[model samples]
Target chain A: MDLTDRPDLAYDVFAKACPSRGTLEHVTGRWGALTLGALAEGSLRFNELRRRVEGVSEKMLSQTLHALERDGLVHREAQPTNPPRVDYELTPLGHEVAGRLLTLIHFLEGRMDEVLGARERYDTARGGR
Target chain B: MDLTDRPDLAYDVFAKACPSRGTLEHVTGRWGALTLGALAEGSLRFNELRRRVEGVSEKMLSQTLHALERDGLVHREAQPTNPPRVDYELTPLGHEVAGRLLTLIHFLEGRMDEVLGARERYDTARGGR
Candidate 1:
């Protein structure tokens, strides 16, 4: 359903108990963001995703994937092969969400020098934190 | 400086040691995202911000602001008034980042029904989590 068709479903994220807040956490969470970003390139096996996201523990990646899958932002495909092949990919909705996230991610990545500079100045002024 | 002029600063968020990852976490963290979203409308005092972001404790809000300010994404202005008014607002860089974040946030807010539906199906399939 299109958002325009239902203005009544105005889910405000600012509200403490809003379901949107939970889903937003999942989308932007440490592991969740990286997992979605990795899948945006293409489908990848579970182990490949773990490698691509770096520093993610086996359990955390598993949890992150389950959250994204439940949110309908990821598709998990399990093959009945020898050892059972499992792959993860973004759904169409996932692609749109990941694209928006990447814009933010790339924007931050591009301006790291400024951020580092700011950190140094802030630290120097605070007598080094 | 434009990103085009700095091709060498390709800070990848997927890398474990990237500073960008830390900064990204501050931007997308539970309280951080809401704090930034609130400030995007305009400047606000510490108390005003606390009220607007809903559910954020004073301590957490203070911490979030400090991190954002250190990263150059937020500006903290302390007025030399009678009681001393401290206002927080997004810096130019913060504005750009917040705009990108709001896009992702609003997109998720608009599609929450789908997310909720998916959650129900997922829970039911697993005999309710």
Candidate 2:
């Protein structure tokens, strides 16, 4: 599936009407990225996910999960146990996406000093904006 | 820098207060992602970029460029020709980031059929939402 060589994809995200754009948004959206990153480590329950993702509100986390699940990047399992256990984990496709995402993430984290220095220089040049 | 093995990076994006999270948002935000991806092919004038990115407004594109520039991921070159010329291109760091972004993008574009199929199954299970 070499997209670069395929003209039949009909999914150029650069085009406004492509559904790929929407899926891209779901994968890269603020909460969605973090949620996927957290799940990449392992499956987690609802509350566990909320805690791992830091500042996501319950509503937002739920919504994010639903979106990911609908896109087939996430799988949700509910157990009819005493307290009704539910857990979420990445699908194989989700793992691949998360791996690429984490590569970018870790790269940025490793280069924060350069980024911070650039910010300082930009601000100083802008008369401390 | 092997972020997985480094404890001193001190820039965990999963933490709400980490500045890396802000950088991640700038790189992956709707317009930001599109803008960087567009520039990865080559430098482009402002109007050229807007046309390539397909739905970005003048104001949003300007704002997105400023943010990327401030973050050191974009280089904005202004020329003093008669009508004046401004071009946008990825910095070396920006190129690296954009490469990773494109990988994810092309992957998504290639798999959109699976994604759409998932969406259809999901909507059907929900009684056609």
Candidate 3:
């Protein structure tokens, strides 16, 4: 079964104490969204992920990857060499979330014109904030 | 057309300069996610939204709703009266994005057990961080 298609489990995101909130934060974080989207295309070396994610600091990149890895949404593999080679890929679960996230990003990107128009109207109505 | 089903729009979220990045940030923010999800069921009053989204401060909730409204993802209707009641609901575009986001949240919440297990394994291997 695809990791993203779990139908038998449930929790209320609205609950203050639900563990799902932390997971949501990790899955939908600013960098987290981009990282998963990029990786959804395929696995990449550390530098490749950093490059694809654009403007992500090395520290932030590693932290994001580490958190995803810890949550089982991402898998990190190390190849022993003169210098260790590390590669990151989505687990089946990661792909599921990434696919949906990519769709949302695409949708938002497509609607930029509308969003910008609304922003202009809002600002105008508010007499410029 | 269902706003969530846009196939003709595209943008590289990987690029740092994409305006969609800003939109994505607003849509997927911590409080933003819960707010959108709550509003998806139906239009809600300010206090109703506050109650459903638990753990959100009044300032943060208002800020999130304003951003969502500005982005054209949500509709805010004010019934001028003694107290001027305001109700929030998803726009077509908002419904599309919120639908996907809610799915992801459901997915993540469903898999909390896996995430916790993974975290335990990760910590064990790291000798406890």
lDDT of 3 at A23: 81
Residue range B12-116, candidate 1, lDDT tens digits: 899999999999999999999999999999999999998988899989999999999999999999899998899899999999999999999999998888899
Q: Each prediction's Cα RMSD?
A: 3.4, 3.2, 5.3
Q: Which ten residues in a row have the lowest lDDT in candidate 1 chain B?
A: B1-10
Fraction of native A-B contacts kept, per candidate: 0.91, 0.83, 0.85
State the DockQ of every prediction: 0.86, 0.84, 0.68
lDDT (C-alpha) at residue A29 in model 3: 90
lDDT of 3 by residue, A1-97 (tens): 5634745534677988877888888889989999999999899999999889999999999899999999889999898876889889999888988
Query: Best to worst by TM-score, what's the order?
Result: 2, 1, 3
State the lDDT at B14 in candidate 1. Answer: 97
TM-score of model 1 vs. true structure: 0.94
DockQ of predicted model 2: 0.84
**Top model by DockQ, which number?**
1
Global lDDT scores for all candidate models: 0.93, 0.93, 0.87
Which of candidates 1 and 3 is the stronger one according to lDDT? Answer: 1
What candidate 1 gets wrong by more than 4 Å, as runs, is A1-9, B1-9
lDDT of 2 by residue, B1-129 (tens): 686586566698999999999999999989889999999999999999999999999999999999999999999999989899998999999999999999999888888889999999999999997
Angstrom error at residue B7, model 3: 11
